[model samples]
Target: MSLSPRFYDLLMKGSFFFVGGLAGSMYATHHHHDNLKILKQDLNILHPPTREFGHAEEKVEVSKDLAVRDVLKYGNPGPIADALARKAYVAAYDRRLRHSAWTAEHLTAASIARPPTTDTSGPVDRGKSKFIEDEDLPIPFRARLADYFKSGYDRGHMVPAADAKSSQEAMDETFLLSNIAPQVGDGFNRHYWAYLEDWCRRLTGNFADVYVFTVPLYLPRLGTDWEMACVIGSPPNVSVVLASKPSSPLTPDVLELSAGAFVLPNAAIPDTAPMESFVMPIEAVEHAAGIQLFSKAVKAAAKPICATTKCELIIRKFDDAQKKPNLRRAVSGLV
Candidate 1:
């Protein structure tokens, strides 16, 4: 097909974008047709940089094998990301999500394996997950989640303990730290976790139809780092996935609505919008933590955390490159 140079340029750019994950890496190893297509299309161009696609294929070492690391960052980042998808809280290993593709190279090259996490009833001993004793913010209030820090809230994860023994090797991908987010017990155990489990199976069974790999869509704001840990696979689903059950309130979605705990559903989505996917409802979150959210803004769709279920989302970075502040709303600028 004949096309304008500009249009052809867009096709090349789009192709570069399309081959973004482990699949792309696989292409590097095996797909001569794709390679030749790129070459034939670009042969007439003035000059092809030493690196054609900028940073898509840079090599890096991770703690384990290079092959494993590449799969983690690129090939499987999407599956893990999908498994980790939840409405609230800043999860552990979240920092990795915002890294640029260049970051993948660093990880792959390092081949440094990530330490595993466990469900310690007490604070983690250094190498485990983070629990910085800031002494400033009322971790007490957050840890216990009582009356203090009325406005402050916790972001707990639907999947807890970060235990890889949770599921089968194929399914264990969901246990990656990338798949976790701050969540409340009532919300998660009762509804969110189950929903996530169901979601995970669906992805495994039917997601190949929609597999576009990704890089960190945005830079961490203020240079804050997001963390991640490797979740090795196990037989049968992880014990954690099975243990993830949310107990219903005396009634479903009916918790003691606190001044802050509330749920306000968004208006019927616009017709022009793409498919809409939302996390659990505010009622579910409220029911889990025994509190309400956004009481002041009862009309808004946002919810709040309970005092006892204390969790918090660490805002890592912002995409300040954009001229205007409000427009940069995505976690990753491109995402």
Candidate 2:
């Protein structure tokens, strides 16, 4: 109460300094918490929540490797195991079919570019590479080019060579016989199938990422008990039937094994075709390829998007699609 002037001044200054420091701390703490709240909101958008599957309501863990956007778009149907994860994609190879039951790839704008062009320069010497049997197979069934020689079908690729053009090694990996299917060489492989591959590449220009799922379908049809001989090479009728009918339905059996390809753009599709056109039901792919494509949780979300049969693939030349097998030409041709 009876303090000197200097002491009183010093006391007032110290009080002011103390209050200022407390206010500063409070502001910093409040700002920090606000920033954290915003971050949590963004993460929920990016990572979503774990979803349940089936009537069992089992909660499966989302793979740490996949982003939520990828799961939502691609519907990672697990082959129920037996997936061989390689440099570019994952495949479940079926030796009986001499091709992949199905193959899945997540292509990003970042990954598809050679020099990252909107347009790709198809590989220069890719034709020089030959289809070799996948050494990775446990019991090697030689799906040699010679096997298909004069057999009457083109060695169609489950994962087209154009998609693997990101690198030479990636392109070479695609050549393994395990990845090839006997497709109608003239119409399906060279024409419509190739167009689909081109469509997939063009997707990168519009969206940052695109997911592609492909399977060789042996769709059943009428008047073509003949297709069994040509496609499966069994019943001793394959050569005989191909000789007689150069064009027939791509047959699996009386039971339909339709080829299914689903392309899911992570963002909006930039094409004139409606999204339903590219939507392929997981059930169709599963029935045809005999492999589970996505996890149960992924399937539940993707089913609605895939619930359509009107596809964008336009097959103009049905007659030429089924081609005659050239045995002599097999020695020097690339599928």
Candidate 3:
């Protein structure tokens, strides 16, 4: 189905953030009582002074001390994300969701190239890679192999395995549960999503540097109250943004950046569906996912990626080319 007019309008506005390089490094620390007091002060700005008609306004200070102190007595219950760096990509894993909040990868001709035969290790092989839990994460917060067992979803890679063809270790890193989410197997992940991924990789040919961010989003349905659903799995929607710097310089010292954002449902999509139909505003994606993807200056200066290059997806009959494997049998061994 096509997106609503409102979504189309947002796309036309033509401004969105493209986090210049990779996501910033994040550090975790123990929360102290002093920090809680500072947080209370910052939160108090939400309180507005009360006033009556035609009377002097009364200034009231809301005492947030008790609430803040009680809430943080144990420590800040955070919406915490674990920053992870792999051989091929960088990602932030959401502990609550048990999947990556987003993954960033820098793709260049050399980065995605197959390894030389002279290397000690053989070229990266997808057949040899296995889906494994990220041991770096706490056991309680990791996405378990059992979660997708008979769950009717694919253990989809946020950073495509093909993007990490440079090394066997890099390809294996993409199989980590932290970099995966529940995706519809047939028409979506195996078909259309794969096509979109190939398109991003192809950008390396035209641009000197290609950066892609994969984000899992939960957008509300239009014209209805936003209802939350609890599923056996994690995030339901995916948004991917591709930003590229042109190979040739526009000026001796400058190279222009161009980017495009696309959001797709975690369901089967028809091959006939135009890739352009999924075009989304970068602002819309940032607001929906609660993450700033780019700075104002970068957004203002970036040219619409589709304008600089063709945004069409090449149809590859992946399903026809390969037989569907039984999800249960495949993952049962991993357990």
Candidate 4:
């Protein structure tokens, strides 16, 4: 899928609002419709009144109908979810799933560039960063560090730490639990997934701007009834996927956009597997996820990303060093 710069601007600013609603809707529709009603009532109570207060002498007793109308004059603001803005990316935290429903980042050569040696805060270092619970989230809604401990899954990043290399603080922000989901470590996160993240970063070399949206989707198993279940402690995160749209200036008044959406199973994907095998239509992704990613005008004018650039992965293995530690942690049931 391809998009105009105008469309990209709109998405970067408002995508999270749609994603947050999508996550809340999925959670409510699948597991808690009744709870949603209660949530609406709670939101009504928590939402500040729009009316201005008056002096005691000027105050008047408003009718119940009038009061209700005043409260809803602008329409109901659905269940409130966390809209997180980090140093390098923005994300919508899914309180019910205890992870991000989706994360968005804009990549460029400058944005992902490594800091200079003379920098005061020091160059971005992944080793110095540790996975931590997002304290900003309510205690009950936060994805605890203990949840992934010994869960036989990696604390997979939706927005890769590599994309935040411009600063140490940027990299550290990527470690927040709000941006993580459970993923198979060896073949998926450490290998193939890392390659995909690298590919997104590499797009900066080809296009002036690369916009990426990472979303975790609960796709139904083939030939089986749709079921949504996750273990309490070790939540089974769903199929993780991302859509990338790169736009370059074609002329002073025109831009060229190319896009592609790829869905990868949370399970390990072999290095030999062709990247094209995972290619999916952008509309399919929107339908399955119940969120519109782009406008029809953008979709109509966009070019297929694979046609614009080689849809291939550059193999780089990190499992040799990580395997032992991951196995040890899995055995000890600790992170």
Candidate 5:
């Protein structure tokens, strides 16, 4: 066959172009793969593959075996300006209320292991520690032991004495008037309140550490005169009671720092009362207290596992939680 000169020339050029293109593609592919491998190595150093997406793998080292002390975090929520009674437990005393706004403690099985230093019912030996005025307070507003005498209210403790069982100094610190409140005598303080305290100590059985916030809530109350009052202190100051008839039109939500007691058990309470009954959301407390209880650091350190109301554990017997025959309505006329 006779080939045209133009056709031959075009064929030779096309062949040369194909060979050059092929060589260029092979070199580019090799270089691209090398660059990709280097990029992958850099990525691996920055972030290795985790077990799952949106998850991170980290290695944390600890110097000592984990203790309850190592787990719990501390915070005080109050007039950040107020003096703090930093003892075995901590309290923020409100001189205006003449009571602690809140008392907090970190409890553990080991922390509460020791027997109570003093008899639970017996008289406190002043030699050990006495309920004296909190010199910590300013003079005019200080609460004194004399104020509680014959006041028809027990010098109630926000932080129970039993929680301070580990040491005499700790137990004694609990007796300070700063930590005391005018709690109702036999029914609430000595009975139901005591029961709650016992339940708190019992929690050590389940959790390594329990962070507790013992708060005093002065909610609205019905007075002897059938008047509504927000009781603030032990001795009801009649002047502070706002005279508003029930029939009157409401303007704003009226809340009295009158009376309510809350016990927030962190872990599963003994299969008794519905755990939901005891577990309270921090927001509820913050609303009632008009103060933020948990700070950012506290929230970050160990978020409360039972902050939500979802509960499945029934730990205590219902009937057993009933008030005793002799138990008077201690919170009566108060809440």
Candidate 6:
């Protein structure tokens, strides 16, 4: 038996109203919530204020009475939103760092490699860099950096490959020119790299978000070519810099701490030109690299080394024993 025309019309009208109401309710719950808006919410800048550069506003406006909701914007913002949010965050913290008693240890590494020009206009457009993509570093240091990243070096990445390998989008992001650096043998690569990746992931889940970038080829020895790499992302909260001394071509001394090294960026972000203030965080970076670049100094007291004849002989012997793995086929540029 078919329903009467009048009854059918009434049923259709009720269903339409119900669907419309549900849609309207959701829209109001998140988008229209006043507290979620930027203007209404309480903004905290962890870093100290910088007299040189003042604060900038987050344009997302919020109302006084609306309720707040925990919303995650992973894919929603895509890359643009991610960039902007990071910029805003950096602007806040950097100002804070300048004001607080917190002192930043500056680091600079110099290498003179002919740059590879990259054309920005087209697929093959990046201009040929004046310096080579890979620097032909001084003999002593070239052997040293190579030794740092030999087969046993493990191809460790400061910006982890796994994080980028999770998907095509992630993988492509990893390939970005800014997020790369060459490292030594697999020992540190396998163990140390994984530790850092896991640590960053943990920080993301704990902190609202994390912005990171890894600089490649920090060949700071004098007489090497000039090379510079910087990322376009928003600044990070914390920064870690790992450094080592090239004692010999085979065996190098990995310092427990290097004062002037790259920033292990878990939080702090870099913006000022290279000449400006330097940034490095000991704790967060310690977590990222899993190696204390420096040994502990208790009560600001420095430890005295005995430098005895026997001890010195043993140290030299160990350095001499370190084997240099051949990469003649892998790297053709080197003789």
Candidate number with greatest TM-score: 3
Give lDDT tens digits, candidate 4, residues 1-335: 12234322322221111111111123222322232233223223223245432322344685679888899899966555689999999988888878887788988889999978684566668999999989989987888888988776688888989999888889999999999887656556776677678777888887777888887764322222534322133222222223333333455346677887776544444454555555556665555454567777777777887778776666654357656422110111110
The root-mean-square deviation over C-alpha atoms between each candidate and the true structure, in angstroms, is 23.4, 30.9, 14.9, 15.1, 32.9, 27.9
Q: Write the per-residue lDDT of candidate 5 for residues 259-330, one digit (tens) a residue.
A: 112332111112123222333334334444545555444444443443311222212223455753432221
Please provide, for model 1 over 1-335, each residue's C-alpha lDDT reduced to its tens digit, 9 standing for 90 to 100.
12224323322332121011111122222332332234223221312334233331245664687777766765553322112222211232222322112101101111112235547433323234342222222232222222213412122222333222222331233323343222222222223233323323322221111111111111011112434222211000111100011134455443222112111011111111111112123332322222222232432422222222222111112247554433211121111
Number of colliding residue pairs in each model: 55, 10, 2, 1, 12, 66
- Measured by lDDT, the strongest candidate is 3
Per-model TM values vs. the true structure: 0.20, 0.48, 0.71, 0.67, 0.49, 0.24
Q: Report residue 283 deviation for candidate 3 (angstroms).
A: 0.3
Instruction: At residue 187, give the lDDT of candidate 1.
Output: 20
Candidate 6 achieves a global lDDT of 0.24
Segments in model 2 whose C-alpha atoms lie over 4 Å from true places:
1-83, 115-124, 218-280, 296-335
TM-score of 6: 0.24
Candidate 6: residue 242 lDDT (0-100): 27
Model 3: worst 10 consecutive residues (lDDT sum): 20-29
Q: Which stretches of candidate 1 lie over 4 Å from their true place?
A: 1-53, 59-152, 158-194, 202-335
TM-score winner between 3 and 4, please give it. Answer: 3
TM-score of candidate 1 relative to the true fold: 0.20
Tens digits of per-residue lDDT for model 3 on 47-76? 212421231223467567998878778987
- What lDDT is reached at residue 163 by model 5? 83
Q: Model 2: which residue pairs collide?
A: 76-294, 76-295, 77-293, 77-294, 78-293, 78-294, 150-327, 152-325, 218-252, 229-238
TM match of model 5 to true structure: 0.49
Give the poorly placed runs of model 4, Cα more than 4 Å off.
1-78, 221-250, 318-335
What lDDT does the true structure give each of the candidates?
Answer: 0.23, 0.43, 0.63, 0.60, 0.45, 0.24
Using TM-score, rank the candidates from best to worst. Answer: 3, 4, 5, 2, 6, 1
Candidate 2 lDDT, tens digit per residue, 1-335? 12234322322221100000000133333432342233223223222355322342445886676576666685755433245676677788766655666677777666666644345644434776678878777555446768888865567666767677676778788888877766533323555345456555555554344667665443222222533211232110000000011122564232211223342211111122222333334543343333455555555433232222222332222345477532211110111
Better of 1 and 4 by lDDT: 4
